[model samples]
Target: MTSFQMPNSADQINLREWLDEQSRQLGFDGLRITDTHLGDASERLNQWLAEGRHGQMEYMARHAQLRSDPGLLVPGTVRVICVTMNYLSPVIDFDQEWQRLAEPTHAVVSMYARGRDYHKVMRNRLQEFALLIEKQIGSFGYRVFTDSAPLMEVELARKAGLGWRGKHTLLLNRESGSTFFLGEILVDVPLPIDQEEESHCGTCQSCIDICPTQAITAPYQLDARRCISYLTIENPDAIPVEFRRAIGNRVYGCDDCQLICPWNKFAQRTALPDFAERHGLGRASLLQLWSWTEDEFEKRHEGSAIRRIGYQRWRRNLAVAMGNALADEAVSEVDKDELREVLRNALPTSDEMVVEHIEWALDS
Candidate 1:
């Protein structure tokens, strides 16, 4: 944690220019800056939690102070930097696959995971961004992260004028919308701060309407327990029976809300191919994905975000999708029978939660 000291009076380095040059060379699409202030969100967060909107993702409550107070996480921090990169079109057919889920006969994976793991991609890029800063300012107290903790990424981004936070709680830019990932570098350089932008959600509620589980309880308020992302990736237990059928063909994650977002119309594709999908995940069939064993899951998801759910959740998700596919009138008897066989064999070796899901799938 080495640091460099700089005079308090600002000089004419044109931070915007240096930032643009460094980020462009480092292969970044965009950057924005914000003051350390977080706006009225602190009160809103308190109200959201007082209503128990967070649900089982208790970790959200633990980092409340660190999330709101940047100084608590990095002492002497005066400026926040935010960055975004388009992760759209990693798998070309993902949107089409999601559309197919309407048939209840196709497997639906979240659009974000249709490609490689973003954590690896963003973390590496954030580190690179940090390096660029160090090169300019010499040694400086800074930390880089992308969704690594409860650091109020969207709030900080909006504060930096990166973009406005939409009703869905994602940072949105006029040019890029919210289809990209947000990363940050906390620094104590006392850089001239940027103004926070006004929110643009303005009478729009598409995200709330599109959620299958009604996870967005209200504007900017989310109930994680009902969120498909939480249920599939966080819970690691039997999905509540009420929401299983509504979960549809989504095997790993859900992006219905984001897909329906108006802002995403401006979402761009990446120049970096590392975000590209491997193993045909964007259009994988229920039977195709369900056939994977523990070893297969491990190998296929090697550097992909899909690995977070692990083999157990993988099977659990595929079983639910297979059940949906099996029950669909559009599927062939041969495919249905094959799906049944896969579930039948998988049941004997599964834990109780998985076994219950498998049973539900079989019944479907």
Candidate 2:
């Protein structure tokens, strides 16, 4: 059944057909129907929680049984429509780009945040899918969510056959690798469930070997506390000193595991323009960003995922990068002095968190 325009003759549109057509029209790389019953996913989630691997993601703990039970989050959630959209572009030199990240003179925003805020982009699309369903099936209960929800999105996605859970704990698919976002619509209406995609990780431990912080302790398990993405974005407290240097210029999130994955050769790009690179993001200079005033950062990163970190973390990240830059023997003395002056000026007036970073930048 096509997910788009259901046959005109049917009084009740086949949801399976509707989902397929809409996913195609939405430029989503893949979509699959799934049941809300996460089953073993719920059990594994409980064990993961008990292990405390989630760190300070207390929300994961708060959900309790709800994390596994969609009926608790959205009652009568008979079907879960899981979708994935590839956001990577071809020709990005994985090694060279990450090397630049190691260079203190460069600022490294995560590949995902180098573009627009995916939350804004994905939420709107999910809402549209919900609206389409309402139009077809009449006011059925539904809720649209991306990463923001506590519905164990990866579990649902895996069940939907969108992708297999790679060793790195991300959904990996042949069509797009793991460079994609996952979203789901939990609805009261039942739809035929798609079979789960089988794991293809095999003997390949590419993601584990390539992780800079060694966050992936094993093939299937990831320690989020050691993860750069969680450290930079989720943990607002002072970064654990041990991981700080390894963090390098990565101020937003980390993608070393994904970049090193051989499967990423198949990663696809978003058909929507929303995911394209923004000015001064993908390849901007460290010093150039250091010069941005709070207002400038706010205005430039408008509607960007980077904005969520706020300007202080933005400066803190810059200070860390500037510290790295200062380590570079090639930087001209004059440029180095100028960079120091910027950090100095930013210190007295900056917040405590940023001031600490500024001090670190100076000492570095």
Candidate 3:
């Protein structure tokens, strides 16, 4: 870790400069300051929610005001210190990941969820960064947020110039791409704000074109209802039949958009081992993950983001993937038969949701 020395004159050592140094030492890739105003992002959010684009994530609609304005989220906030952390595991090769996604029997968990829960990782680091800022500048009013709060993290980060919002509606940078986690520190103290970055998406629509479910409705617009990530992780309802085949072998979240993005070629690997693959998630087979008992699922995913969905959702997602595998021409008839037999065996003991999905997969 690099040590940052504050200048002998306290006045000469700007808080932002000190914060930047501390952030680097703390393993954050990018940091920028922005004001409380969220501008048109608030209106766009309202429109999206009004259209029911958030799907079953009702919490998004509940905190509209707080999410749009940092001042409202954290009273007396004058600046937002947005931070970005690249989480692309060095162990992963994009080409290999896409190849694995193609395999009917392989379980494709999203890259970001392969390790520790980012909510915990980012929050802990942000809290530490905040405390460090206070030690340097004396007592200060602030709040740290990862994805835990009803905050518009990507919008805040975009405004802060950590990166620009990609067409897939994720933060993208020339150096780190969209394979990063975003966090924010809403502060009362005014700080030097960064200029917003210009969008570099240009004419490329690979993210939109490559979506298995066509979740990206248009350039810069996403319909979360059709998103595989939302279908597998957020929506507690039955996996929509329309998207079952497209869901393929993705047992958790989907990364097709990010994986398809040209900018992702430049995505940086994570500095923290916290983002490394665990429980062989990056290469686990669908049958392997599906065979875990509820207790085993709980024990294995104790510190992982995938655990949040619970064993029931986990089973439901895997069942959907298995169904897709059954229908895939790439999978042999013998493999399909085995998958069908597995689904049938689980039907007698599975929950109503899981049973329905299992039956669907078997029939698919």
Candidate 4:
């Protein structure tokens, strides 16, 4: 527990302006404040969970109440100071991303996970921002979060006017598109709230239309069970055979929804070196990633978000993609033969789960 030295009303008025400037200096692309009432979003979350749309993510159901109310998660919370940091690196071109997706042998990791783990990068910076706020006023009751807690980050960010939720259900800013990480500071102070942005997605169903697995059931709704991001990263069990063909060569999280979004043309590139592509993840092929030993995977993905998925899941995803490549007529016989040989070589040593996926790849 902590105490607060409340700022004078005049000081409170100027604090918002100061925060905006300081956040920009600290590499935050956008910052906004909002009250902690999440009535509709909470209800929607409960309904989504009831439908089992969250898939194997049992945490979502366990923390439903806490996620609905930040004050419950962090006592004394009155306002949420939401911040956005663009993660799209300058080297990423949307056209190139489409080209990579078309290439059956090329591995496509999500744009966000190609760099350093955002959970660490954003949380550290959020703590600094919170400390700066404390310095400006005095002892302040607050807690910083960046996808660490059970709270509804995207909903809070949407209320704070960081951006409107797109049809794809990702926060979308006209200036930054949907290529940013969200963080928040839960504070006891009653910061002036920003107005919510109106939905600008008029009738754009491009995201729903482009989903390889039809994960987006409707505008503003996503069924995570069908989502490649969930299958590749969150699902601990076998990658279901039905979606394996659709998974294509995505060895990690999927970015199809964002890539097809028209507004993403305005997606801003990040200046932070922390988000620069690592280990050539943005362009690595299925064969290249499949070559990594468990030790190599651990060593290469050190300090990366991808490492959290562990080596077993990593191999599972790669094997699925390699199987998809084997089925592709576009892939050369030479590459397909090599993929089959690699799958066969790993059969004896792989765990049962991985061996099943590897055998599936061989059968393809």
Candidate 5:
């Protein structure tokens, strides 16, 4: 880690104000600072892991201790500058999303995944922000992180006054709602810290009530094994049959919880173009996405986070959605036949996992 002299308290206050201005100019929606300690969030993480609620995401457990203490993750780190970037593009319509969910033939990719990969976008901006800080105060001991690290980011952001944790376990802001990405910079400087936001959720279980899979077992408690996002994106194996019907037409992720939250009505559109929809993903039909060849999937999602799931899992998720569409009474016989024919055509060539899912779809 590079070291630099700390500014005096008066200069530090001025630097903090400068950071806020510069962060907004760089397209970050919100910025706040907090110390390295995670407090009780660490204990909750351990208990969640012990119960195996993390499902197959082994990295969460592997780096448990490091996640609780940022200083351990990056030695000498004292203050963490947390930033938020709203990812909800202006073109997205909540009502249209609900309509798409009702349309069994349509594929509902999560709004976040429709655009450029957030990891790359957030990571690049965070690096640039850190560089600006370095230039302002000379070389400093710092490390940038987006979702790339195992650290408790939501908790850090919550502690930094970015937002309060909702029942769905996502950070929710009064102004921006929960439609944003979080990034952090761990620095050696003891910057002025922000106060934590009080939970505004008060008796509101809308997120839990609206979950298709009951993944939010209780307020602030999620069973990842039952989450559609985890099932489609994180779990690498064949998705459990129990959650297949509940998964509906969601091929990438389910946004039902966020959609149901009253706070999300205030969700702000992103100021950056990185989150703009790509490849007509927001309006694609199940058949349209199903028709994508493996090469086409790779090429179309070249710079997308969706590409990381690989062709197999992508096909598996599509198969599940297609199956749900097949079973939907709303779909006409003609469309069902077409869907069945498509599944039959792919059966001869798909891998073992995809073939099983395809057979299940055909059964529907």
Candidate 6:
């Protein structure tokens, strides 16, 4: 933590504009300021937690209050500085992305997780921005967050005029679409706030209609239990038998909603190399990723977000994808035969969770 310096009246008047310029120089795509209050979000959050929509992500429940009231998380935080960074790699062939997701042999890692970990990337950049703040007007009470805290990032960003929440529940901007990561700096400085942007979703339900698992049960409502992203990344148990076939070859995370959204046509490519595809994960085959030994998994995913799931969840997800691939008529008989042999071979050595998924794959 850096030392804090009190800001003068002139500093307060000009800080927001300076912060925006410096933030852009630091590689953030968008930035806005807003107060710490969350209005009715606290009540809505309470209801969501009570309904258990978060599935096995108990942390969402445990930190429910702190998330809605930013002041509670960082005392003296008068305003929040929200920033957006696009992560869509330039090399992405938008036309083939959906086709790859439906292909049984190719694994579809979520667009965001295919590169270096955003948690590190965002946190480092936010910290650098914070240092810039200290240099301009001295250090103030502030805390940086990059999807690493209990804060309601999407809500805060929406409040800051960064974007509006899409029907799929991710932040959507007219310029960047919903293919960006949001980070925040909770600060004591009372910077002028930006006007919130209004929703532009209209009657378009493309995201909801396109979700493979129908996880977005209603507009702006998501049952995480049915979300492929939640199932593949957050839920640490068996891949539910009901959703396995629908999961297809998505071994890690899901981006079907964003891919099908019309706004994605305007989605910008990331300027930072830290978000470029690493280890060829964007196009890696299920068989290739499945063959990684524990040591290889550790070494390959050292700086990648997918590594957080560990070997068990990784292999379990691959097994489900392989199972789906085995049943896919689109896959060649040779690939199905190879997948079967691989699943059978993996069964004997896998832990109970992975073994069960492997058996299910073989049955498929």
Best by TM-score: 5
Assess each prediction's global lDDT (C-alpha) against the native: 0.78, 0.80, 0.88, 0.92, 0.94, 0.89
Stretches of candidate 4 off by over 4 Å are: 1-10
Query: Residue 85 of model 3: what lDDT?
Result: 86
Residue-wise C-alpha lDDT for candidate 5, range 185-270, written one tens digit per residue: 99998778999999999899999999999999989999999999999999999999999999999999889998889999999999
Per-residue lDDT for 1-364 in model 3, tens only? 1133334545544665777789999989999889878889999999999999999899999999889887887788888999988888889999999899878899999999998999899999999998888787677788899998888988888888888888899989998899889888888876667899999999999999999999999988999999999999998979889998889899899999998899988999987999999999999888899889999999999888888899899999999999889888989988888888888889889999999998888777
| Superposition-based RMSD of candidate 2 using all C-alpha atoms, in angstroms | 3.5
Model 3: clashing residue pairs? none
Q: What is the lDDT of candidate 3?
A: 0.88
**Candidate 5, which segments miss by more than 4 Å at Cα?**
1-9
Count of backbone clashes, every candidate in sequence: 3, 10, 0, 0, 0, 2
Candidate 2, residues 1-364: lDDT per residue as tens digits?
1233223435334656676888778767788888877778777778878999889989889977777778788877778888887776443557777687666667777888877888888888889878887787667778898888678888789888988999999989888899888888887765556788888889999889988789999978988899989888887776776777778777788888888888887877766778787875767778888788899989999999888888887777777768767767877788789889988988778999988878887987
RMSD of 5: 1.1
Ranking by lDDT: 5, 4, 6, 3, 2, 1
Q: How well does each candidate superpose onto the true structure, as a TM-score?
A: 0.92, 0.91, 0.95, 0.98, 0.98, 0.96
The segments of candidate 3 whose C-alpha lies over 4 angstroms from its true place after superposition are 1-14
- Pitting candidate 3 against candidate 5, the one with the higher lDDT is 5
> Which candidate wins on lDDT?
5
TM-score of 1: 0.92
Task: List candidate 2 stretches off by more than 4 Å.
Answer: 1-15, 89-96, 328-335
Q: Is candidate 4 or candidate 5 better by lDDT?
A: 5
> In candidate 6, what residue range of length 10 has the lowest lDDT sum?
1-10
Per-residue lDDT tens digits for candidate 4, residues 1-364, read 4465557779777877899999999999999999999979899999999999999899999999999999999999999999999999999999999899899999999999999999999999999999998888777789999999999999999999988999889999899889999999999987778999988888889999999999999988999999999999999999999999999989999998999888988999999999999999999988899899999999999999999999999999999999989999999999889989988999999999999999898888
The alpha-carbon deviation from the true structure for residue 54 of candidate 4, after best TM-score superposition, in angstroms, is 0.9
- For candidate 1, lDDT tens digit of each residue in 187-281? 87766666767777789999999899898878877887798888888876788888887787888878887778888777777777777767877
10 residues in a row with least lDDT, candidate 4: 1-10
